[model samples]
Target: MASNRPAESTSFAPSGTQTIGFASRTDEGPWEEWNPTEDSVRPVRGRHRVTKQRGGGLARSSTVLGVGVMAAVGAGGMATAQTGKPPVSISLPDLSSVTDSAKALIGEEQASAPKGSATVLSTAGVSTTEAAAGTKNAGEALRARIMQQAESQQDRIAAEAAKAAEAAAAKKAAAAAAKAQDAARTKAAAEKKAAEAEARKKAEAARLAELAKQFALPTSSYTLTSRFGDAGAMWSSGYHTGLDFAAPTGTLIKAVHSGTITQAGWAGSYGYRTVLTLDDGTELWFCHQSSISVTVGQKVSTGDVIGRVGATGNVTGPHLHLEVHPNGGATGIDPMAWLQSKGLNP
Candidate 1:
């Protein structure tokens, strides 16, 4: 380290005794101090020349040498601090040595640099601009990829929704078809039942018409004055056992069916009477008649005139009482019902 102490100074004698000499040694010969004069000094041979100034100051070459030494010392100190290494010893250089060393260092730096390194450093701004452009391109590519993926997802969802809707519609259509089929089946069954009923009714009507051809009404132009089983004081059996037909006294009575006249004539309260016996053993009796036109044991056909209506046998007016007996039983049955069985409405 350099000290902070001041440098030693030498004082020269005053004006008139200025001549002084110093003993010095030189490469050429033994040194001798001599007063310097322009005539006594020799001209330097190199490009640089040393000359004494009017103010007795150092030469410009010496000043340049001092500045070079300071610069080198400063640079060495800075390098030591940055590298964290022990400081290296530096020797002060003579004027000629400093110049030669600076030239050599500059040459070495030029040789160590890589090829085209200077050109690359000079265009550094261009590289920064290109890097920014590359980043922008990459961002655009990423955004495009994201958009494509979103679109694909949307399409998938839409397809699924449409498929579901179509399935629901198909199911609804199937249900409607099933309901319509059931209705059609029910209607067909109802129509079949109605047709069967109509057919049965027609068959019954045909049967009744055929029976009407074989049977006949016993009388005409007469009103039913009394029905069998009627309760009245005029009847001997307490309840009437025969049907009565009322009309003018001359109303003719007919045989209900083809039968034999088994008995004819008056019998007590029955003023005039006639009995008809059918081949099936069913008997028909006519009473309260004005007169009898049939005789016993005589065969008569249906619709034959057998008697006339008259007020007799404890009757209130002119009317014929008719009775029916199935298989000739003593107790007679309702004549009106028997007439209906033979297809007679009267």
Candidate 2:
């Protein structure tokens, strides 16, 4: 054994001062594997290396020591340059956070490891390497992305369906309410029409009952001969202008109601005619009478016999022609309707 020691030793650091060392993010494993004399340690960042030595072992040792100091001070990163074994990368945890396992490794290296030696890295498998590298297969990445997208799409579709269901329900309720409103309006209209008709009927009945006590027929023994507005050329007017009553030539023709006799005598085509005037200036003419009992301006009461029926002047037969001249107008009205207006149905 030729002095198992270095030929020389050197350091760039000042004399008798502690060189700075660095803490790394990776561990180098066991401590007994480093031997700069046989293995090359390449500089990681700047220019320096602890290369294998064939001559001047002491000087090589001194250089390796210098490189080691740089490595300890975190001179970027360091690794053995020779092959056969992979280049070893070495680091340390933060001194404040060092675990028991890391502390044991450091203690073992300081107590048993020789000078100019490095720590060797050992791994369980490729899977462990891959885990440290944060690598995943293509299939696994794709599967995770697909699962996230599927979940998102499903949530969106479910939300849309819920909104559609709610809208349909609201529409159905509105339609039902509209239909109910229409039905109510129809029912109310029908009820209003029925009520109005009933009221009119009652009013008419009451009027007729009152008029029954105030008026009487002109001739009770006569038969209906013609109606007003009858289309015939039997008179000067194409349409008959009066209501007619047929009876014996000598039948009694009474005054229709209490009134003054304005004229009583033969009056041309209205031969043996008599004109009665009411309080409101309405005129009543009785024509085709056999004889007249009252003179002009003579007052007469209702049901008083004022003339006898005859066919003296423009008459097809013995009949009394009664016409209504409202306000003594030249044009007479439909006698039947005029009588009904007074609550007398004839």
Candidate 3:
């Protein structure tokens, strides 16, 4: 069988005055205590050496250093936590911070983010600078549109008003021209009528002067017995209204002027009278004629025989009673004065 006892009396000394001996349980009595010399202890330094400590070792020191580094990192992370700052930030594509400079470069990465991230960015609140720019641009566009419309409307209205004014002026001018033409026409017509009236008046005056020269006395030899308007018992209207020429019967009675014979026959109380009418409305009566020589409407020359002289028109003697009337009135004027106006002395 194999023994399991220890060997006896192996001694090793460390440093001064301290010695340790090793023995088995069956070793003899009277052990010796030895002292170590001064040359036994030496400083040693090398790689891959095992150092011995009393209780604590290198594992404890390494654990203490790791705990201190973790505490410092936790404090730094806590300090920036309010601002959402990360610890040890790196340039990893998916985990990068949202910086102002990096946000402009998000086009390529926008598709990789969540589906609604692009929508959130697009609908974000506008800054004061962006809002002011948009307002200025919109106001300029609105003002341009309004000004264009107002200018177009103003031009149209002005053109219409000008056209209306021109039409009114044309109408007024036409009315004035028509009035002038009408006035000229009226003046011409009035002048024409006045000229015709003057010519007719001159011709009538010439004809009247010629007729006055042709009239002559009714008898060559006679005596004026009664004058015109002699109030005596020989008149029916209370007056002798005509001149009585007392002449012998069967004497050649001549027509006073170139006139038509209106009557050459016997009248009541006037035996064989003849009435002659001239163109100037004068009437001559030769009454109590012995014989008639002309009929009605027979034209006779001056001193032409119309009837033989006798008594006529309420006469009493067998004598020629010659009377003259200017306008066939019942009253008569003095034959002597009327003959003198015709350049004849009765």
Backbone clash total for model 2 is 6
Cα lDDT, all candidates: 0.73, 0.72, 0.66
Q: TM-score of every model? A: 0.48, 0.56, 0.37
In model 2, the Cα lDDT at residue 74 comes to 62
- Candidate 2: which pairs clash? 7-58, 8-58, 21-72, 22-72, 34-117, 34-118
TM-score of 2: 0.56
- The true-versus-predicted C-alpha distance at residue 68 of model 1, in Å, is 44
lDDT of 1 by residue, 1-346 (tens): 9879898775443332332376433334233456999876876544343343444323332443344445535544321235668867766544463465445443443465565543111112323234345556777988999999999999999999999999999999999999999999999999999999998878866776777776787778889978989998878899999998888998988887887999998877877888899999988888888989978999988788988888767778998888898999999998888888667788
Task: Please rank every candidate by lDDT, starting with the best.
Answer: 1, 2, 3
Query: Per-residue lDDT tens digits of candidate 3, residues 1-346?
Result: 9988987874453233433366334334344566676665454323123232336524333333333334334445321235566666533222123233233333324454466432221123432245446667877889999999999999999999999999999999999999999999999988989989989877766765675678777776777787777788756677765666677777788887888888878877667888988878788887778789999989999989887766554677656666778877665677767765665665
Preferred candidate (lDDT higher): 1 or 3:
1
Q: Which clashing pairs does model 1 show?
A: 22-33
Q: Between prediction 2 and prediction 3, which has the larger lDDT?
A: 2
User: Model 2 scores what on Cα lDDT?
Assistant: 0.72
Error of 2 at 197 (Å): 3.1
lDDT for each residue of candidate 2 in 153-233, tens digit (9 for 90 to 100) = 999999999999999999999999999999999999989989888999889878876775666678867788799888887
